[model samples]
Target: MEPPEIRFQILYYLYNKYYGGQTGKLHSAEKIIQETELKNIDRNLINGDIAYLYSSDLVTGKRSIGNGGYPPSIIITNKGIDLVENIINEIIVNILNQQDNRIVKNKIELIAKSDQRTRITKIWGYVKEKPELFVNIGEKALKLFLSGGY
Candidate 1:
């Protein structure tokens, strides 16, 4: 189950990254609010989310050494990479097994069943374009199927 607080935090983090995090810059709360469309910015909620991320070692914060301090800049850590990898792997596995085929398939039916069809199609298309990626995915799928854990 997804927690509302976590969901909000994830959205906020993505919003910040979309705006300027990619450039190694921090966005202000107002900017985050504007981008995320969350009404009545709740400091408590934001703080809670930050705390959770911090606890998970997914982000870190520091005070800026300037006249007017800016909001803490967040960076994804190795833990964050692991988290994203796990999520992506789970999503790929789920979409591939939609028909309970016990293996990954290149059928549109299974891809369409995914909530993010466009993303799934794009990812699978990319995988198809790259023989190495396809081989890796196929190996992983075969391992899972042979293990009888699907």
Candidate 2:
């Protein structure tokens, strides 16, 4: 079985894709798997992960009864959205503290103040336009933050 953290990542990814402007949206399991690039993972495993989130009140969805295609749709709860946003804020603050460059720090601060949706978009824009700005953050940390992990 995958670690619990991996399962939790599903919740985070859902928040990034569907929260904020798209709040309360219900998306197909197939669409979610494709977006997160978890297509190779078994449908049952995804169902188990969704079940875990559901049990935690972080999500609402139907899990396929067997190991076949994942049925129905999924929605992230407000609680789940808050959880992901809080983690992101913590990560941004940590990155800002570690950064000595004033310019980089300011940029990160701006991104942090924005809504979750805007933050992700801004971060990616920065990454693509000014890769050098995030050199001090370390690749692993940056990747984690970008991939919906703290």
Candidate 3:
């Protein structure tokens, strides 16, 4: 298995797109990078993760090779879907069973209130339209929150 945080992010992105009417449609590798915003994680690392996920039969897809392949993409297998759901359910149960889980429960509720796909899509669109704007806005928002604007 991959590192918990990295694995969770990858699975979450796949699950979101899979449920967002994409079905078996392939998602470009570039799109995956953009969606996950894995700046701190090397692209090669994600590629390795993808390869490992594939070897474990959790996912199946294609990769861009040289210049002939043109574009790259990936698609989750049914196994991946099942595994992700199970992992998510287990995580929820674990959190709920934790002592003094009130704060974690609240955070979960906050996340559940939003449509993840829409939020991700908007952010991805912004990145493509103006990456500098996206970075600046995120920094500004975080700064504002730190300054007690939340």
Candidate maximizing lDDT: 2
Most TM-score-accurate candidate = 2
The TM-score of candidate 3 is 0.60
C-alpha local distance difference test of each model: 0.46, 0.64, 0.55
TM-score of each: 0.45, 0.63, 0.60
Report, for all candidates in order, the number of backbone clashes: 0, 0, 0
* Candidate 3 residue pairs that clash: none
Q: lDDT of candidate 3?
A: 0.55
Better of 1 and 3 by TM-score: 3
The 10 consecutive residues of candidate 3 with the worst lDDT sum are: 141-150
After superposition, the stretches of candidate 2 with alpha carbons farther than 4 Å from their true spots are: 1-9, 16-22, 42-44, 62-72, 120-150
How would you order the candidates by lDDT, starting with the best? Answer: 2, 3, 1
Each candidate: RMSD: 11.3, 5.4, 11.5
User: Residues 26-104, candidate 2, lDDT per residue (tens digit)?
Assistant: 8776787787647788877777666656766777766666734333677888877776565556557666777788888
